[model samples]
Target chain A: MSPVNSPLAKKLNSFAPLSPDELTCLADLQARRRTVAAMTEIVHEGQTDHRAWILQEGWANCYKLVPNGGRQIIGFPLPGDFMGLRSILLRTSDHSFASLTDAVVTEVPKHRIDEIFQAFPRLATSILWAMSRDEAMVVEHLVSLGRRTAIEGLAHLFLELGQRLSLVDLVSGSGFACPLNQYVLADALGLSAVHVNRVLRQLRERGLVSVKAHQVIIHDLDGLRELAGYDSTYLNGDRPAR
Target chain B: MSPVNSPLAKKLNSFAPLSPDELTCLADLQARRRTVAAMTEIVHEGQTDHRAWILQEGWANCYKLVPNGGRQIIGFPLPGDFMGLRSILLRTSDHSFASLTDAVVTEVPKHRIDEIFQAFPRLATSILWAMSRDEAMVVEHLVSLGRRTAIEGLAHLFLELGQRLSLVDLVSGSGFACPLNQYVLADALGLSAVHVNRVLRQLRERGLVSVKAHQVIIHDLDGLRELAGYDSTYLNGDRPAR
Candidate 1:
């Protein structure tokens, strides 16, 4: 059975407070539903064209495959997340996005998205805001990868994901279920799988974090914050008015 | 004598036409100018407040410093480029901006910027567009660092810079001065200084490029493009409806 409510629809409303009629109208623009098994490719690199996908449920990973067959996972989008926006302008997929779990998504055609942009300027503005924010998150990631140590890098990522998920009510506070695999974590952190496992063990030993079969509990928020040198200012979507 | 005009500004205004009045208004906003010798710090990490600066002329590096003294150059801004916008929303400067060469810049108080944003929505929108483009460039950089080889990383940077500078007429075609030292290149490319020298030597040996003093001449554009896998679509700023 599919998830009854659309978390993405709610997210869209939160940005602009669209009415029910508008939401229903907007949802109708998307095409038929699609599903992918866990660890399946949703979009591939070097693909000339793309169809925009709105995640109905499940998680997806957006990444680039290196020429040497190595991988670098740039981002992981949860429910309500949008990928394929790059295709909206570039006429191609710049990076491949794959499912991390059984995922239900709906493809939105480019022509319809353009129509929506014209019909709903506020929605388009919200999208621009979201994409710009996505870019800022990339900025933070660049800073972390280019500057932090392995442990620090891992801590920052955890803190980041926790805070982001919390904003959308996914997590309670300092902890979230990190469903991604260690190999994927390695790619995200620019480390080997062995290195990522060793770091994870070190964190567990230090009482900084606890990870089990499917959950990660950040035991020492303050310690993790110190290790990550993390400040929550970067996560704020609202800024002081000019 | 000062260059009398901003080359980069001219290139940008080519796409989005600005009146002489608008140009003069921008020049006025940059009235309070200051010049720093080479290796001067423009903004520092952990700084509590925002102080905006415009690159008037010369080279500068924006980077984050780790506790162990490792540095990661997030980007290099040229003349007419704006820096410190990240701090505008974050309320604190998390990374440092420093000049690589004797440089001149103009300071605009954050309050003044805020005032302008409120008073002139068009100017504000233009700034927003500029920042969006900046963020897009960083995404490309992340892909390069995460997925490309060291040689390919350097090649992509060169090609990207050449294209960007060409838009500003800084490049005649496939050649332009690097305007940065080997050490700066090292940090920017996430390589050691020794590694940078080796890669440059490799590029030279392969007859792909000739670097003398500060000038770089691309001996093989097609080879460089193939090596970098650069597609201009990502950098294209021409906005279409939706």
Candidate 2:
């Protein structure tokens, strides 16, 4: 994809308009791209790495291993999402990041980010905006896990992923490429894989949504939103007026 | 309390050394303090308030009202913690902030913060650090709700609160002023109030912890950590060396 039409550029532009010069700087900064196989560990938990990454293609997840030998997927980084932004502030990694599919990612060195921050303060502010939105998403996820029912939790996740991915033209109508399997959904929703399958089947039976292979199609968007109690305000991309 | 001895100052210092001038600026920015009654709503969800607040004394919680008339406590901000940092990025509030007890809070205007961002970039970075750590804590809480047992969840909360409070000298000998009652714990842990009481009784009977009035004392820190699978690395205050 051309740099102007890249997912990263689209996502960042939703927050604020990037100047031509700023876009060029960002493209140059991300020029050193690398590809990794599916299910590859990009950054392991407790591994101290100073470089940051931006997902150029495919999906990735940040997860932690529970004490009871279970895996908990905390955050899903889609195309255009920045991974390991916390590594710039914290000295150590608190969770592991892995590719859900064969992925293309841009590695940004620490010094380059520092230079960007010094030269382009508005760009730095946009980065902060992205990070704040990330925190808001996590907080919403907490609400799902702590209060929502199993069906509601799964429905909420689907609606969320659909909305987020749509920002970068990843969604066509109500359907999108959903690479997550039952096990990953189970870990994220805190349900057994069997329960995840059952929930999906129930949604299908209810004519709310359908999953075929790696694609998820929502038949009744309003019904799914009602069932999940999903609110899109938290995901608003409008910049706060100064 | 003196500005230098304040909990907010101490917490900011953990990220980077604050210059005397910076400390004075912060103190000036927080000079407009207000006292709020116990259980008072500081900021309601969807309210468009641009000002930011720092809890100077007493406890406060950020929570959301679920559709089923239940409440989910998203975060319990300690004495030093900043409330509604998202307000700086998002135009409207996503959740409500209420005082758990009669509290003192400092209001800092948005323009003042913008000036600070331009004048003191290191201090700005420190604020980002605090926000990142807050997100990490919420992710850990999600793990508790999704995977941990009732007992393990309560134990983990206690350990986390203790460690965080200790940073500002609020903790003493593995104990601290835990103002959270059973109902609050119920909301935070996604358990019923009866279940919360039962879990507390179980901890007391096992000689692992004890609660009297509003204080919680941990009998065995190591044993509690082992039981909760607690890791303090996420709460580390060490700043990344520049």
lDDT of each: 0.72, 0.85
Give one digit per residue, the lDDT tens place, for model 2 in A163-186: 889889999987999999999999
lDDT of 1 at B84: 79
TM-score of 2: 0.92
Per-residue error (Å), model 1, residue A45: 9.7
* Candidate 1: Cα lDDT at A42: 80
**Which stretches of candidate 1 lie above 4 Å from their native place?**
A1-58, A64-71, A78-136, A172-175, A192-210, A219-233, A236-242, B1-4, B17-33, B45-51, B86-93, B108-126, B172-174, B238-242
Once superposed on the true structure, which residue ranges of model 2 sit more than 4 Å away at CA?
A: A89-92, A118-122, A238-242, B14-22, B89-93, B118-122, B238-242
For candidate 1, lDDT tens digit of each residue in A174-227?
Answer: 567768888988888778899989999999999998778867789999999899
For each candidate, the DockQ is 0.24, 0.50
**Which numbered prediction scores highest in lDDT against the true structure?**
2
Q: In model 2, what lDDT does residue A30 have?
A: 76
Q: Model 2, range B37-155, lDDT digits (tens) per residue?
A: 99999888877678778898999999998887888998899988888777865455678999999999998778888898889878877777787677778888989988889999999
